[model samples]
Target: MTSEKGIAAVEFALALMGLLLFFAIFIQFFIFFAANERATFAGFAASRVFSVQGIGPAVETSEKIDSDSIMTFETNRVAVARQIPMPSGINNFLTQGRGFSIEIEIPTFNELDYKNRLEQDDNDF
Candidate 1:
């Protein structure tokens, strides 16, 4: 029979490489999801802060967010995103950053009240 020495070893090595590649992909997805979850939480937290802090007289009180803190409140939530475990070229195909940024929109009570008043006036007519 022909020499088949180290054939099984080569096959095993190839299989192991495939498994490692799959595992790397799986881990990257996990990281992406985890970071997304964290970003979501931060969004909610930022909204809460905006709502709670941008209350009555806050606009008058603070120089920033003045004239209507509720309306003028602007901030950004930064989320650290992870690149898929791959070569630079492949990773670039996936994404090109160590993180991502999210902009949170907080409802302005003044605008809501103004709209509500307009609606009520229209209803009265």
Candidate 2:
């Protein structure tokens, strides 16, 4: 019947809309996760530079990551902080400035101390 066909078309349209909305949400979440991964990698890379080169070079490298991220490093400690930007409406209702922070400690190396520890362990065995 004509009425039956109309009802079926309406239901299919509604279902299609729902499916599209779900797909959009999935894509948004994927982008968010990718951004997070990049931020984390940047933090670790900056920390490595700080440990190997020094604070100045590390700070310079971190500055290239993005405007939303912050990096700081001292003699033996490095820290990176990042903020995730969400849609303006969602940000207003939810907690503002959602972000992550990472800190790494650079180990100090002392050849004499290491050698002494090794000898002590050898004597104990």
Strongest candidate by lDDT: 2
Off by over 4 Å in 2: 65-67, 90-125
Q: Count the backbone clashes (under 3 Å) in each candidate.
A: 1, 0
lDDT of 2 by residue, 13-113 (tens): 99999999798768757766766666666666777777677777776776677445676665554555666656665455554544323333333344566
Q: Model 1, 17: alpha-carbon shift in Å?
A: 0.2
Q: After superposition, how far is residue 36 of candidate 2 from its true place, in Å?
A: 1.2
TM-score of each: 0.50, 0.65
Please provide, for model 1 over 17-87, each residue's C-alpha lDDT reduced to its tens digit, 9 standing for 90 to 100: 99998998788677656655544444444444544575334333332322111223443322222222345
lDDT of 2: 0.65
Error of 1 at 117 (Å): 13
